[model samples]
Target: MMKRNRSCVLALCVAAALGTASLGGCSVGEALHEGVTAVAESASKAARFDVSGTIEQTTMLDNDVLTVVAESLEYRNDVAYLKLSLTNNTEGTIDVTACTGGYDANYVNDCMLSEGYFSCEIPAGETAEDEVDFSLQELQLYGIQKISVLGLGLRVVDEEYDELFKDMVEVKTLLYGSEGVDSSTFAGSIDSPALAEKLEYEFKAASTTAPDLAETDIEIPAAFLFINKDGDIAVMAELRNNTEETLRVQAGNITINGLAAYEGESWSGGTVAAGKRGVMSLRLSSVVEYGDLLFDSSKAAEDADSTEGKEGVDLSNVKEIGMTISTKDANGNTISDPVDVAFAF
Candidate 1:
């Protein structure tokens, strides 16, 4: 009886395979139909620009046709300055404009002129030098975590006609930190094979601990947590053991916008040693959309202070807003309890 049962199973499997093969069988006519369908789909969508050009960096601006290369960048306190050189290659005169656009440490819009963008016109066929400056406060306000120079726009004009050049040649540069002052200049010619090279910048990672704040002895810092441009909410807290002895601790819980913390898949866990500091990074998934974390001008204006006859109030421009944190002991006991960090904008 066992042998008969095994035979029946094998036969069923063979029959199923045959049925599947029959359903998937394709004839010559079917293949031709599929080819025509694919051709029609491809023909419906096409690109508008023929992006088959090259990019290069240069240091000399005298040659009418040229690209600018950033040679050095430095930041002190909160101000940042970028030094760059331009080169001209064409025999005829070429007019050019350049600028910087990217994010700062706080991931805010820390572009040139606080607008996170810059533009400057270069004299025809003349290689010029220039610098772009920005504030650290503006960088932190926008949560700008990175910066880079993408390309340039050029315009050529004659008595009879004029032409606008957009991204004519790509210029690549290495982003160095404040420490590295003696570095090679980023420059090259357009359409050259060497223009494909990219300059890399180094970043350092660091962390710090805070003083413990228990229910009876807790003192909240005068700061507000906000939503970041990446749609993440962050609240920083310090924990310190005032007592002489080390205290055993466990994970702290946080609540925001009526939603409980430690409920998401990206939850953090760890222990805090006595006299040592720890950080808690939390996100408010329930209250945030993908790109709504950054400060919006409309929202800030609506929440601005409305005191009569007084100077307009400026709330903290938070990259990440509206967050709070709470702590717990090793025995699963509540700490100072969770508190909401109010957001004004």
Candidate 2:
């Protein structure tokens, strides 16, 4: 994939980020048309959500320099769309940048739609509008429904990508008749057939030791479960953070059946916010390939005759899995000693 520096032509930068044909020095209108076409093409199977036209006009940002409004909400397949209208009130051009952020009870805070929509500039006294798409199915998989609010954290920057404001601006828009969120509405709902089958099997693993609350400030409320997504198995570790700081959780020194397994990092776990529950998922096929496990290839080569037609380490032979779970604070400081967690087949 080709990448462009921020110093490049703004329209071309946006075109590259949006995966659209280069629009050299084109106006914002032309770039927006091309970007929207790319988005629609990426989601060719998506149908228009019925409530798109009913979204209330919510003001996201308003100031002497810029005014932003959440114009509407729409759905493209499993992705949610938030159309924004930005007016540059200042004498100079400005750029708005946004990315995926955390979510709360009311809304899935941020979406994957950044860079492309706001990478271009809004000229002085001119209004630029576009839609940003985010994953709605991921939220549905977590058993959350009846959304009434959508939040966005945006950053205002100058044409040179320098910060124009001191802090990130957050905006929330209401949708779906202001209904409250309820996880019980669809607790076990899964869209993929392979994932549904794994759920029926009810695959779960138990930890042998408990985490020290004084040190870790976290609790495991549920057993680690095997989640099959697109034919890949990811071990889901659910954690509830009780402290008032964001916790970065990861696994190391991992092993399967007493043999070293994939030791690569799985960022699906990411960061869990304070006083909130989140998932730290470790996919089995991290370094090698999906549906394949790490194993002793030298030993396998020695038994080539018996291992004929065998692809990877068989899951049936995986009797136990072990790892050291460590955590860090928001400042990248180690919060607690690594805890060794083990699970038996």
lDDT of each candidate versus the true structure? 0.30, 0.47
TM-score of 1: 0.26
Judged by whole-model lDDT over C-alpha atoms, candidate 1 comes out at 0.30
Task: Please list all clashing residue pairs in model 2, or write none if there are none.
Answer: none
Residue range 169-256, candidate 2, lDDT tens digits: 4344444444444332122433223323322212445454544545666676544434221223345555666777667666666665
**Top-TM-score structure, candidate number:** 2
RMSD of each: 28.5, 12.7
Number of backbone collisions per candidate? 44, 0
CA deviation > 4 Å runs, candidate 1: 1-64, 91-93, 99-125, 145-161, 168-345
